[model samples]
Target: MQENKNEKPFIPTLGITIGDMNGIGPEVIIKSVMNPKIFDLVNLVVYGHGKVLSHYKNLLGVDKFSFNQTNNAGQIRYNRLNVINCVEDIEVNPGEETKEAGALALAAIQKATEDLKEGKIDAIVTAPINKNNIQSDDFKFPGHTEYFTEAFGAHESLMFLCGERIRIGVATGHISIAQIKDRLNADVIRKKLELMLKSLKKDFNIGKPKIAVLGLNPHAGEDGLLGNEEIEIIQPVINEFKEKGELVFGPYPADGFFGNSSQSKFDGILAMYHDQGLIPFKTLAFEEGVNFTAGLSAVRTSPDHGTAYNIAGKGIANEQSMRSAIYMAKDVLLARRENTH
Candidate 1:
């Protein structure tokens, strides 16, 4: 589709993937789009089966909303919900893990990602997917962060979690705890810090972003008493960047950083591993957190939580995180465009 310059201001179209059908993906997607105001902000194209969405609509007792089925992005109507059906004859059994559910989830992600790459969609907001069941020959990445990093051919990507007051990014993610120590190095640390700094400037429109780096061990290695990673690895990188006039600080102990409210002093925080960052992030912003993959050629965001299998068809899933993911994707896209122009 070609851009029409004479029309009203261009609104980017966001493609949403239906995560594992047996999970809460469809429920949250339906609940999120029910708000008419969301339609005004961006055009939405849902890549999933129409029947699955209809099932959730009926189950949730939401009768007022309807979807317009279309196979092409150019045919999407900005004023109504648009769906591009990617699966059929699928059974949706809530709280159950099945091959069919995983296959359906993979199909939606592949299709939506293709559209995102082709510029048919401006950005993508994915619902949650179960990492175990959603594995396939075609979908072999550990999680969305790894999947998108390869999909967009990005040299590297940062798994950033953002909320109202806190922003945290992990240096290493979706890996075993034992592997974290081996993974901590000066080069990896430098790249993560660079990604976080650039993202804070371009994606979030923050100027001169101040970043805090957390240590790998207790009391920041207790000055080499607990571990030497802080002294041998982390501090050297921080010092290198600091001398270059970047607003970077720390190698602070993770416990005292969050306990003393030191996180409030920086624009972003970089943790050495997954649990070190997410444990405190979810504690503070579980409901409204957004998972954004920074350094990708195209923008992608997902809710900070996973597929809630236990609450899958209960119609009680909170849609706040899903909604925040959509809004964050839009904000990042807009910020990138503004920075480019």
Candidate 2:
């Protein structure tokens, strides 16, 4: 589907949460919004402390731009960078994770999430957060996907990583390798596949998306030689979807799938675990991938990277992934609107 430039554009308001203050989240976000073209794409409301952003702006030598402060989401200034301070009197220490940093990160996310649910913001683009540090009684999910699933009351959500060419959805995310086998089940696989299919059609505007499902074991269990997940759980779901006339295929070996460039043949891919899909995805599209949460009522996206503490305040953190996340969120929001209409 093609967007008509002649039509009146629907500019969305995007809420950005600062993930870990000690990480490269603020640095990358500063670099991303510095481009005037980004302001043209969407009205951005940053949910973090102004002091934290100010420190990064100076540390990174980004002096020409300034964030317009606002106390309310409705007061966001279009065509400019706006900030809503979620914390006050906070000292930012780059390249070090602390309880204060995690607490502030959670505060920012909480505020942004509330605004997103209230329809004050059309979409949300989050920065990287430390899974270990950013833990509290209020925030107890494994990662953002599970948090959003319960927050938005969605039955299921998919951790979809997308770039210009490849899009992958992981069935299980942020879990230990030892727990993967027990977690692999037909119900889980089927729900993930359904979510991926729906997101491809509605959010990506793909009418008939062909999805490739990867096997859990080596050589897809070598026909139950290595494991029975392929035959018992994975293949059954694929067959069920196929019999229903869906363009789904494979319990293909994970190694050959990306090694042989088979990913280019399909519109999307569904992997049984996190590393199986992400390792190949990052290798291929790390610099420009966006982590999109599919099957949520509200759109949310983040850079396909984590807090680069080593490069936090070095002023060298690549902003490409963050920029891609912002643009992807806008595109997905637009596509969803078009789909609904």
Residues 230-316 of candidate 1: C-alpha lDDT, one tens digit per residue:
999999999999999999999999999999999889999999999999999999999999999999879999999888899988999
Q: Show model 2 residue runs off by greater than 4 Å.
A: 1-7
Q: How far is 28's C-alpha from truth in model 1 (Å)?
A: 1.1
lDDT digits (tens) for residues 178-296 of candidate 2: 99988879999999999999999999999999999999998999988899889888998999999999999999999988889999999999998999999999999999999999999
- Give me the displacement of residue 100 in model 2, in angstroms: 1.0
Clashes of each: 0, 0
Cα error, residue 70 of model 1, in Å, equals 1.1
In candidate 1, position 266 carries an lDDT of 91
Candidate 2 has a TM-score of 0.97
The lDDT of model 1 is 0.92
Q: Whole-model Cα lDDT per candidate?
A: 0.92, 0.92
The TM-score of candidate 1 is 0.97
Error of 1 at 198 (Å): 0.5
Model 1, C-alpha of 226: deviation from truth (Å): 0.4
